[model samples]
Target: MMKSIIDILIYAHDGRGLGHVSRSVAIGLAVRRLFPHLSVLLVTGCGATAELIGEGELDWIKLPSYKTKISCGKSCGDLGPSNIDDKVLGTVRAESLSDLVDVYKPKVILADHTPQGKHKELLRAVEGSTDSKWVLGVRAVVGDVDKVWSELSADTFTSRYSDILWYGDSSVTGSSELDKLSKHFQKIPFETGYVSRFKELRNIVTDVCTHKKLAGVVSIPWSGEGTSVLLEKVAEVLGGFDISEGIWKVYMNHRDPRVCGVKKSFECHPNVYLEQLGPSFLTDLANSRSAIIYGGYNSLTDVMGAGVPSVVLLRGMKDGEQEEHAAILSKSSSAIVNVFPEDEVTVEALRNSLEKCLKTKVEPSNMVLNGAANAARYLAELAGVRDANG
Candidate 1:
């Protein structure tokens, strides 16, 4: 690591789910790995950032956060969309961003999801930066583009950002929302197949003995940052399972088992071996006989990378990004079984998938999971950075 030539500031407005924050973390990790001299600063509202991003990194700024109204129907936990005023909130966030920009003087500013942020704050904050590269990172499907266009308008698209970074595969499939925004796209888009933190597994496809070794893993899926609407439902369905004979580990992400089932404590859940999240919890999923997990961006790649035969959950609704990813991955390989909620949750599919994953030995797919590294190297190029040798 030589003299620091650039500093990268990533603004991840986690008004939605951990998806945006997680994706940004993957990119930041990649950036730090590629440009060891470049310091990465991430600004986020996700409460789990401190716990997930590691301590003493001294790289994150926590902000007063709010969650999307769509995700949280009635119960607005702590802070929700109804609790916020766009005008006042925007002004407050803009001031904080502007102050940070003046001091940090970032060489590259990457704004995830919204260019205007939760309330048009990013547009107002980066007004005076003459040397910084402004970039907008977007997912494949970002909801009704017409609604987005009406909210942001055509005027907001011109000269607001330097590049459009798309983190989805353009050839195999496409995002309807991104397709609609294509006419407004001006700059060259840097598209990555998908941004995943883990590299694709090589040759560790040994089968987990199900009958011989009685063990399983369950995780409640979350759709947004503030609350786990999906988790609450899944937990209830899982509570009825009679797995007392086997050891079951559950990652109750945002759901309380008491609210759903799990009458006993973690220590007394009889069959449930573990139900708490830890620093290296994914390792447990990677080493499981079979597992049930969410279909989020990172979760999909991480489990697939782990080469564990698993069951993926879907909300079975429109504008759900995970559904598409689940469809693609499930089709690409037979390692994962996709399950959806019908009328209510169809847990039978989960049970069947678990039985199949546990009893069978499947070959590992050769799909590449190097998107994080690719994104890191590409962002370095976007910053127009060159090493001393170059």
Candidate 2:
């Protein structure tokens, strides 16, 4: 039997935040809408990928997953309790990706964030598929400059990508970092200006700040060892506000096994309410009086694009991307306040920031927010789909 041809294949090795998978799904949905005749397949390692895809919107494949963490100043993989060797799992993911390429023979393949995919698994597949146009989709701030340039300068992987898509604006906070990358790479990438579900968040919302008196918004969808502590601090700080003020809304990932413990330990404040992370997260953020968010790309995109005054808690990852992003944005925008590690969070500081945020006047941002549609159009053109429409 013959395998069906796939018009577009998108791969996102997302094991942490919803950024990669969210961006991938947004582009896939946009492509499907713009070119109804085309078939789109999203291949990702995130278990939540399925939840993000709307019914009959796009086909998806979920691969075995592994999480990356920082330990002893070096990045390492956590395979959970599985006895399978880390290398063996890597091989399995690699082979699975290669098999999809060999069988489906997609006209175009898009690899998100990591150019060569997680553990360099997608490199072999890209090298073997001579007929497909393999593209790389990058976020606004990709950690260290030297490290990123060193990785992209490699001929083996750099030569394999036919096009590069940047999901950020050069005019934003991290423009200088992006400038360094462009100068080093010597190739101007197509700027998509912060890929988001703009039609879903920025454009469609006529009711801005429906919760004007609402204290703030907090979202930590991926739980960890310190998740409970963070939640406590949020409650403590928000609860400190006058009771007459509206409630503090928090969004969490109930699906994470660790979250149950976090929920149980949570001493819910009378003014704080917890809700599971859902499609309404961005919309809620847009309508919020203020937001307390981690320093992730999508979080920054939503907060900045919505012009919501926010307090960004830097994650201090090994790559220093989040810290770097928060630092840059702190310098560029007064609407944002940067706080350090979760272990040192002080209620006074958070309260002050929240107060400042509430007082600040923020107009909806004028930045380009139609990156998903822009990316879809570019991908369609790259695939030579002339009949594609807006």
Best by TM-score: 2
> What's the alpha carbon RMSD for model 2?
3.4
Candidate lDDT scores, in order, read 0.61, 0.73
Give lDDT tens digits, candidate 2, residues 1-390.
Answer: 334498889998665678888888888988887787888999987776665663427789978777755453345777733446667777888999999999999888888866667777887797778888888788778876343466544454457776778887777654675566566555567888778653433333455555566667888867655667776667677767876767778888876676666564344567777787876676577677788888777777677766778888765566778777677666656557555676567878888888888888775555666788888989988777875543
Against the hidden true structure, what lDDT does model 2 obtain?
0.73
In model 2, the Cα lDDT at residue 141 comes to 80
* Candidate 1 RMSD computed on C-alpha atoms after optimal superposition onto the true structure: 5.4
lDDT of candidate 1 at residue 336, scale 0 to 100: 74
Note each model's CA RMSD in angstroms: 5.4, 3.4
TM accuracy, model 1: 0.78
Q: How many angstroms is residue 160 displaced in model 1 relative to the true structure, after the best TM-score fit?
A: 2.8
Give me the candidate number with maximum lDDT.
2
Q: How many residue pairs clash in each candidate?
A: 0, 0
